[model samples]
Target chain A: MTENRRYRLTAIAVTLPTLMSATAFEAGASEPGLPQLDIATWPSQLFWLVVLFGVGYLVMAKMVTPRIGAVLEKRRQTLDGDLEKARTASSDAAKTRAEYESDLEKARNNAAEFAKQAAMEATKKAEAADAKVARKLADKVASAEAALAKAKTEALANLNDVAAEAAIDAVAALAGIKTTSSQASKTASSIATKLAKQGAN
Target chain B: MSNSEGMHSPVAQFEIKPLVELSLGGYDVSFTNSSLFMLLAIGVSSIFLISAMRRADMVPGRMQGMAEMIYEFVAEMVRSNVGSEGRPYFPFIFTLFVFLLFGNMLGLIPYSYTFTSQIIVTFAMAAFVFVGVTIIALYKHGLHFFSFFVPAGAPKVLIPFLIVIEVISYFVRPVSLSVRLFANMLAGHTMLKVFAGLAVMISGAGGLAMAGSLLPFVALIGLTGLEVLVAALQAYVFTILTCMYLNDALHLH
Candidate 1:
């Protein structure tokens, strides 16, 4: 404990003189009161302030201000110009869009017209082809009927001959009364003509 | 960082210690701590503005952005407060704003003097503004400027009374302007020093008593932050008040 106390004493002894000197050096200003209240210093403060403030004002007014003002002005002009260009470009784009839309509308209408025309043309062609087929079918039916009438006439002429021969043979064999072939053929022909007329009716 | 001499008084920090002695026309114009800080304010602000605008790009960089922001801020203040007729005075107002801003801000640094804390400095600036605004009013309106004092809508009997009140209010502009800034700076700095000294004194007691110093230290921190706000707020107030005065001068009513 004694050794510890002696060590502290030696340390304090070493630092005390230096600390005292530092304290003396650190004393407040020569005039004890508030430096601001001291009127004597006002002259210097005002003078230096005026000098510095004047210089600052001159530098700012003459040099600093105009330069900054120019930059700001130039920036503003550039911005306004860019905005104007954008506006014009947008309007031009709108005009182009309108024109394109109109053109598209016209093209759509034209396409519909063309499609209608093509469809009508196709319908007409089909109608013409249908009429031509109908006409050909009618002609073929008329020709076919004419051939049938001619065949019927020929068949009747044969039937009359055959019937007249049979009738002459029957009369000669059965009743001993022989009829002439021409008269029999004439009778058979009249019967065949009447039958054909009845069948047509 | 001060020793036994200043430890007795918190106001010791405000003492003007002469670094170099100077004289002019039988007057003591010694360059002191206050003058040095004023010089610092002027030099630093000028240099910051100049350097920031050195590359005044249309697309401004950070420093240029700050400089332009301040420029536009003051420009807008003058424009809004005083109108287009105030264009000629923009440069002066701009300088005044920046000067006070820097003075208030620079004084926040440890061991640096706050020149704006001085009554004489703030008074000088306020008086200058008052006189200049008066001169502008007179120049613009001639003798008719006296009409500004008389209440327009009041009775004729109250005219003289109203004029007296108006004149008193008008003259109080400089006093109120200077004192507002001076008192704010002086009070804030004194409070900060007092708390700091309290903390130091408490801690100097040694042992368990040193723990009590924490309270004062925390208060000091809080006060410092408040002081920073006051510094900026005071600068803005001074500049804006100047603008309002200019507005009154330009438009008498």
Candidate 2:
């Protein structure tokens, strides 16, 4: 429908101008050769030009440009928003990655520290056991030596009694008489004391 | 001079003929071919610009892109030439550019009236701009607007001479502005019509002369191409000049 109206308008526009210039130009051939100099038409031209141009300005300012400007504005906003979203997401990713890397690094450091502590503790325990074993061996040897010396001292103390008994037995066998035990012991003691004096002389 | 009938006279394209005879308070305000083409310019521009943005899509189609591009072009022109102060006059400049652009382009159609070719029409528009700019200057700067006619740095001895020249040139703005556009459209279309008539005339001679019509035809084709450039260029020229004038009005010198 609009196209048909346009065609009609174009048809009239093309045809009427021909008919117009046809007569107007023919008349101008006799007078001044330009019909634009025809002062009579100036008012209408100026009038309609203002009217149509005013109409055009209204249509453009009030209608057309605003819509175009709006669309441009909307597109620009949408693009800026999308870029903002992308930037945020990128920064977030970088932050997360850094956190992850730092976490990993901390964990690795902790593991090494634990291992070092464990090794040191184990070494300390081992060294303590070695010292204890050495101490135990030295104590056992000293106690055994004391026990041997004590046994030797005890055996020598018993030797004197045995000598006294032997002396009593010999005296009884040689004299063929059963002297009193006290007399025998006294005799052994006297003999011993005499042996000691001779040795001192 | 091919003074014969049937599109012979180049000035014929410029003639204004009344289509609707309207009387307003005893004045012959008849709507002529000039009015018709003017209406056509408005209609085409309105339809094209409006319909192009009917969807107002975020991503524009072909026509929509063109509409946006035109909008941006005028906006940037206003921004660059007239600065931010001219933002208020953007619609006016945009309208003028679109109007003239469509007028000049539409007239390129064969048998179409070249309304821009008319001195009366171009002068009317120029006169309006001239007067409007003067009013704005006067209003904005008060009586200081007359100082625009004085040369800023001229010697005291030559001040009068320079002021005379400046005032004459200042008053001549409308004429120069109007005549420049009027003569451009008038000459381009006249040349096209004249060459076209020559081709027609030569082709009528038949035989050898008929083949020779190709020369004028080729030239016509080239001229038509050039005229298309001129149409858009002249529209830009008129509009940018308007911006400059408006700039002068809002900002002195």
The top-ranked prediction according to DockQ is 2
The residue pairs found clashing in candidate 1 are none
DockQ of each: 0.24, 0.34
Candidate 1 structure quality by residue, lDDT tens digits, B137-225: 99999999999999789999999899999999999999889988987887788788879988989999899999999999999999999
| TM-score for candidate 1 | 0.73
Q: Per-residue CA lDDT of candidate 2, range B170-236, in tens?
A: 8888888887898788778878977998899889888987999999999999999999999999999
- Model 1 misplacement above 4 A: A1-32, A108-201, B1-8
Specify the CAPRI tier of model 2.
acceptable
* Ten-residue region with minimum lDDT total, candidate 1 chain A: A16-25
lDDT of candidate model 2 versus the reference: 0.83
- The iRMS of the candidates, in order, is 6.8, 5.0
